[model samples]
Each structure stands twice: as structure tokens, then as C-alpha cells.
Target chain A: MKVTDEILNRFIDGELNSEELKEFKDELNNSRDVQTQLRALQAASVSFKNIKEDSPAVDFTSKLMLSLHKKFKSRRRDSIFIASVASIFVVISLLIIVYILAQIISAAGPNSSFQPGLQVADIFEKIAQTFVSKFSSSSVSIVGTIISFGVIVSGYFYFDFLKSTRSN
Target chain B: MIKLTDSEIIESIKRGNQSDYSILVDRYKNKAYSLLKRMLKNNMEAEEVLQDSFLKAFQALSNFKGEAKFSTWFYRIVYNTALTRLSTKKRKIEMEMSSIDDYEFLKSGFDIHSNEKEDTAKMVNELINRLPEKNAAVVSMFYLDEMSCEEISNVMNLNVTNIKVLLYRSRNILRDMIVQNNLVEELR
Candidate 1:
């Protein structure tokens, strides 16, 4: 079998199997061409080893770290912004739900039946009754649903912000 | 001083010890710079792209799964960033280079006759620099970085067979040049 340059290349790279290795050795012992080719390849390989790696400027690390620091700061600012927006959204949603409840209670004339100040339990019952009564109104249901969805979405964003901050 | 593995360092960075990243940066900077320098053939551009590659790796670190070695992943970033820079400079070639005829490929930039007085290493470096971009990267990564063919395949996004072929062909060219110049003895 004729030994090709590819064979020699694989041989030098130690990619040959045990059978191929034996055949290559036999060929190497017999052929001057194979020997010369192997010699040249080995020389080239050694020359490649002489090529040194290039170094960057002295400040490369410092500059990269500075950029990373900026990136972290920006990321923190974004997390803070998300948290603030989500907090504001949750607060607004709660206020709207409270306002809707108060409007329903006032419309029900609960103050006339309860006298001046009502117990917490009575107030909750009146709010629940009025809420159930108005539950059939599509506008009321939608407003309630929109507020709940907004709050849930805001909670999700807030959770995501916490996760991101912790990971960073 | 017990040295931490790349994964350890990455975990530390992910855990908010971002400063530990400098260790990785220092570790890979030179070898990666060598790769970029050979790929771009411009020291200034190589350094600039090296920085960009590092920043990109840092930004994308959270997405790195440990399926491959860190060197493999990092070099992939470097190789791709260099390719992008090359394309922006309007010098990017097809990554699938096996179809190009060897003669046409050799005729493009196989000039070894220039500067005959340089030493073997310098001559070898010059010859590698004169090769096609992908070919030069294969030689550099294979030898200078001491990366295996599989690792180079991962970085270059080529199949292992193609990488082996490129490596063999490139080393053969260097061998032929060394033989012709009678630099084989000096190299040994």
C-alpha cells in the first residue's frame, strides 16, 4: 500500500489505529519518500510550535472590566426600573379594586342600615354581597378581570426582576 | 494556590462575583488574540475584535451549558466575531471551503519566495498568514492553541473530516515549503 501525505499527517497527529500504525511503520522502514515526507512534516510541526501567542495591550483587562462594570450597573438599573413599574402597577390595581368596592357599598345604602361605624365583618359581608350582585354586569366583570390580570402580570414581572437580580 | 477550573470560574461570575471574570479574560486573551490576529491579519483589528469577543462571551455566559469545554465555547465566539469583522470589511469567504480546487486556492496567496532571510519560525508564521483565512485559523488553532481537531471543528463550525483535511493540506504545504527552503534541519 502506498503511503499518502494524509497518512503521514494522521500518523503525526496520532489519529491512526493500531493496524494502520503497523502498516505505516512497515512503509516507513521501506520507503525513502515516506521518510522524507515524515521528516518534512515533523519539521513543519516543530516550526508551528515556535509561533508565539500575541498579547493584547496592558490595559485590555482593565478596560474590559470597566465595560463589564458598566454593563452590570445598567442591568441593575433596568431591574430597578422593572420593580418600580411593577410596584406602581400593583398599587394602582389595588386602589382601583378598593374604589370599586367603596362605590358599590355607597350605592347599596349600607350606611343607612349600619348606623355610623360598622363592624369589619359587616363591612366585608356588604362588600361581598354587592360584588356578587354586580358580578353579572359585563363591564364590572371585565374591569375586575382587567385589574386582576394586571396585578398578576405585575407580580410576574416583579418575580422576574427578583430572579434576575439574584442571578446577577 | 489551587487553580479553579473554567466552570468554577464561570459559576463564580454567574453568582455575582463578576470580578472573577478577569481570571478567564487573562487566561484566554493571548491565545484568542493570536487566533484573531491570524484571522484578521491586522494587529489593531485583532485586538479590537478580541475585546468585543470577550464582552460577548461575558454577556452570553449565562447561556453556556457545560456540554462542551469552556475553551470550545469561547473559541467559537472568537472565531465568529472575527468572521463578522471580516464580513463587515467585505473580505469574508464561504465557510464551506472544501469545494474550492486546490490549485486555485494555492494560486490565490501561496507566495513563499518573499523574505528568504527570515528564520524558520518567522517564515512559517509568514506562510501561515498568507494562507486563506479559514486555513490559517486551522493551522493556528491546531498548533498554537494546542486544540484538538474536534475542538477546532467546534470553533470553526466545520465537520471533523473537513477540519482534518484542511489541517493535513495546510501542514503539507508548510512541509513542502520547509523542504524546499532546507529549513527542516533547523526546525528539528
Candidate 2:
């Protein structure tokens, strides 16, 4: 019978029945190759079993926990900071867009007489109205836009971080 | 007073009991560190990989389905982490070796009468380290960590049969190396 890997592994593991063991021993006695293979297996096992276990340096756990905590905290803080910065940018952009639109509307209005007193009053009223209306609408739009973009960008960064981290 | 299982510890971590994660870390860190040390053969790299593995395990703990033992799952993370480090280092060394001769060079000085057993063990360890990365991993997991073939299979994502075959092949290779080095005499 051909000495199959399954049989050899079982022999190595000492998992054969008494009769199977007898047959295997007889086969081993007849086959030089089988005897050499068995000896090699035994020697390898002996060498492997002799490997020594080395302990990690003292304070490994404490330092690891501290570092993990700091990493988690930094990641959380970075995400929050990015979101806040993005929100601020969106708010500023909306405010600038609103201020320009108000200026364009006021300059295009029918009250274009440039008499000093009336011009000053009209300009004041226009400035106040623009501030009030634009502040309200821009606040809503800026907050909405900021939230959406912030979420998308933060999500992308988070996933990228996770992917890179996993591979490392 | 209630006892906690690995699953329970994981659940507690998911519920925001972040401190409970230390239990999980404490449980697997040493084993992970040991495996990395053998795989990378560098203490600093092993420690970094160990920390990275634990951080990963903690982050992904919620997704753990209890299909495998927690140690097995954690080992997979550690194994992958160490393999990446080894591969990167291997690439750097391969580039450097292009300029050097292919043949082995003698050390500046040799101790002619080193203790035979100690020399043998050192030679054996070197040969084990020289095995294909996968085989080295299998031998390290099996022999160094005292893990069973099934556990190795889980960590390695291989079938148990494949693990058995790999283990057999690796043992044969190691034996051949030992005999070639004259560490052990061939049986007559």
C-alpha cells in the first residue's frame, strides 16, 4: 500500500489503532524511506518542542492601554475638529453668498435717486434688512449644507482610516 | 455576582464599558506579542504589532460573531499585522541583497567549540525562521504558542486538513535542515 499523507499524519500524531499501528510498524521496517521520514518527523517535533517562550517587557500592558486610549481619543478629536472646521467653512461661504446677493438686490432697486439724506437712509435700511433676512436664511442653509458635507467627508476619512489600519 | 464569558466581555465593551476592554486586551496581548516576536524577530516591531492588533480587535469587537474563539479571532489580527511588517522588511532586504553575493559568508570570528546542544538549537531556530512564511507561521503557532491545529486553522483561515498537511510538510523541511546541518544524525 502507498504510504499516504493521511496515514503518515495519523502515525505522527500517534492516533492509529493497535492493529493499524502494528501494520504501520511492519511497513516502516520494510521501507527505508518511511523510516527516514518518520525519524525526520520525530526530530522536527523535538526541536520545535524545545523552543523557549519569551515574555514581553514589563509595563507592556500598561503602555499599550495608554497608547490605545490616546489613539482613540485623538481619532475622535480629529473627527470632531474636521466637522467643526467644515461647518465653519460652509457657514462662512453661505454668509458671503448672502451678503453679495443682498448688495446686488439693493443696487438694482427702483430707489436709485442719489440725494445725500435719502441715499444715506436707504443705505442704512438696506444694510439692516439684508443682515436680518440673510442671517436667517443663510444660517439654515449653511447648517444643512455643512452637516451633509461634513458627514460625507468624515465618513470617507473614517472608512479610509479603517481600511489602512486593518491592512497594517 | 455574575461570571463573564469572552462574549460577555465583548458585549460589555459594545455597551460602552470601555474599561472592560482591558479584560480582552489582557487575555490575548501576551499570546499576540509572542507570536509577533517569533514572526518578526524584533522586539519593538512585535510590541507595535501587538498594540495595533489589540486596537483592531477592540474596534472590531462588535462585529465578532462568536463563530470562533476570541483568542483565535485575535490571533488572526495579530498574524496579519506581523505578516505585513515582515513582508515590508523582506522587500527592503531583497533590494539590499541584490548587491551582495548569493553565497553564505563566514562571520568575522567563529567559536569552534560552542556547546553542541545550544548550537543545535540556534541552528534549528534559524532554519525554522528560514522556512516559507506560512510554514514558519504554522510551526510558530503550533510549537511556540502551543496551539492546536484547529486553532491554527482558524487563525490562518485554512481548512484543518490543509493545516495538517502544512504542518507535516514543515516538519519534514525542518528535519531535513537539521540533518543537513549535522545537528541530528540520520537514522540508519
Candidate 3:
């Protein structure tokens, strides 16, 4: 039998057939390389097998679970915080736009005659009438646009939810 | 309490039973911790990285395809995490493979070694820890975890043949350590 390192290793580990094993044993007595390899293998395996397994610290599980819980909770909190910030931003932008438009309207004083004795109610009624008439003409298109945007956003979220579920 | 397969538990975890993840943590923490400690060679660092690996695994659990065994998959993550952590310290490790050829053979094969050699035997695992990363990992997995080379190949992402070769080289290195340290009692 032609003995090689891998073959010799297998023989030491009892992996060879009986016929080959005998041939290797016969060769071992004469070959320094084979004998040396076998001794080395034996020493390594015998020592390694004797070492004990180590268990983690007693608080290992609790510590891991606590960390995981904190991570999950923190992620939830981050998403909520982002959503809150976004809504606050939208509300603030709307308030700023209303303020600007109100300033523009006030800058362009009511085109009606300022009868010095005109009641405050009469001026309020006039402003309300002009505001509705100005926007009422395109209300249908504006409502259509808002409804289309709502449908698209909802559809996008629904599809996203579907994709996540399907992947899971 | 019915025993649930890992994949089944994984399915439930994906279905929103997040707490079920604790079962996996409980099951694999020892193994994961042990391997990490072997790789990192530090208990506190191993504990921290172990948590990171588990947390990352849980976060990415949705992507698990259930094709490989869960342990294999999870261990891959742990291995990669250690690999990343090791990269930071890789430059600092000065390997002393200087006297490899000086290894002596046991006289006419192994002799009547006794409990007296227990100290050197004890240093065997420590010697293993000092091997190069891939070699050390293969040795730890094969010996400590009692895993097959095939399973280790999956975890380490190396082919079985290559792993075996590395394992053999690692054994020789270990053998040389045992000899070079003059731990063996005698040549007879």
C-alpha cells in the first residue's frame, strides 16, 4: 500500500479497510515519516478530547433577552417618533401657508366700500362669500385630486403589506 | 409542552410571536457563546458579540428561507460577526510559526503517558486557541462542539476537503506545540 499523509491520517483514525490497515502497519515499523505522523495524531487527538465544554454565564439568557427586548422596543419607538415628527411638520407647514395667504388677503383690502358704520358681521360675511366662490369653481377637480392621492397612498401601503406577508 | 422543530418555531416567530425567539436564544446561546469565546478569546467581548449576533439574526429572521438547518444558518451569522470583529484586531496578532520543522516524533509512537502529563494535556485547548483563525475555528468546531466536518463547512463556508486539510495542519501544529513545549515526558 502506498501511504500518504492523508491516508496515514485516516489509518490512524481507523478509516482504512483491514487489508490496507495491515499494509500500513507493516510500513509504519520501517518508515520514520509514518511513525512520526501517527504519534503526532495520537497526541493531538488524545489531548483535545479531554478538554471540557464551557457553559455561558448564569445570566446569559436573561441578558440576551433583555438586549433583544430593548432593541425591539427602541425600533418601535424610532418609527413612532418619526411619524410624530412628520405629522407635526405637516401641521406646521399648513399653519404657515394659512398665515401667508391671510397676510396676502389682508394686504389687499376688501374691494367693497368701507361704510364707516358697517357691522363686523357684514365684513365677515363678504369675505366668506368671496372665498367660497373663488375656490368652489375648481372644487370638483380638487376633490378628485385629493381622492386619487388618498387611493394611491392606501394602495401603495396595502401592496407593501402584501409583499411583506408573502415574503414571510 | 409539545416539542417544536426549529423551523416551526421560526414560523411562529415570523407570524408575530416575537417572544418565541427566546427559545432559540436559550437553545443556541451556549454554543454561540462558546464559539465566539474561542474566536475572540475574551469572555466579555464574546458575550457582547453573542447578543449582537442573536439580535441581528432575529431582525433578519424574515429573510431565512428555511433551506439550511437553523443552527447552520445561525452559526454562519455568529461566525461572520466574529470574523468582522476579528478583522479589527487582525493586525495585532503576531503568529509564531517560527519553529515548525523542529517538531520531534514520539519514540516508536506514543509511550506510557500518565495523569502526570495532565498539565500539558490541559494546555492542548489553549494551544488550539492560539492557532490561526480558520484553523482554530475548525478545531474548536470539530472537537468541542463535536460537529462533523460537513456541518463545520456549512458554518465556516469552506469546503469539506479544505477544512479537513486545515484540520490536519492544525493537528500537526498542535502536536508540535505539545512536543516543542517539552511537555511530553520521554522519548520512550
Clashes of each: 0, 0, 0
- Model 3 bad stretches (over 4 Å): A12-22, A25-40, A87-168, B92-115, B177-188
Indicate the DockQ of the complex predicted as candidate 1: 0.62
Total clashes in model 3, counting residue pairs 3 or more apart in sequence or in different chains: 0
Q: Compose the digit string of candidate 1's lDDT tens values, residues B1-188.
A: 99999999999999989899999999999999988888798999999999899999999999998899999999999999998999987777543443323524443443445644455566677767767778889988988889988889999999999998888878887888777766666678
Backbone clash pairs in model 2 (N, Cα, C under 3 Å; residues 3+ apart or in different chains), count:
0
Error of 3 at A93 (Å): 8.5
Q: iRMS for model 3?
A: 3.3
- Report iRMS values in order: 1.0, 3.5, 3.3
Quote model 2's TM-score.
Answer: 0.64
Q: What lDDT score is found at residue A37 in candidate 2?
A: 65
> What is the CA-based DockQ of model 2?
0.30
| Cα error of candidate 1 at position B109, Å | 8.9
Each candidate: what lDDT? 0.82, 0.72, 0.73
- The order of the candidates by DockQ, greatest first, is 1, 2, 3
Q: What residue runs in model 2 are displaced by over 4 Å at the alpha carbon?
A: A2-7, A15-22, A31-33, A79-168, B1-4, B87-114, B180-188
Residue-level lDDT tens digits of model 2 in A50-69: 87666677887787778777
Between 2 and 3, whose DockQ is larger? 2
Compute each candidate's TM-score over C-alphas: 0.75, 0.64, 0.66
Those runs of model 1 whose alpha carbons end farther than 4 Å from true positions after fitting are: A89-93, A111-168, B94-118
DockQ of each: 0.62, 0.30, 0.28
Q: Which CAPRI tier for candidate 1?
A: medium
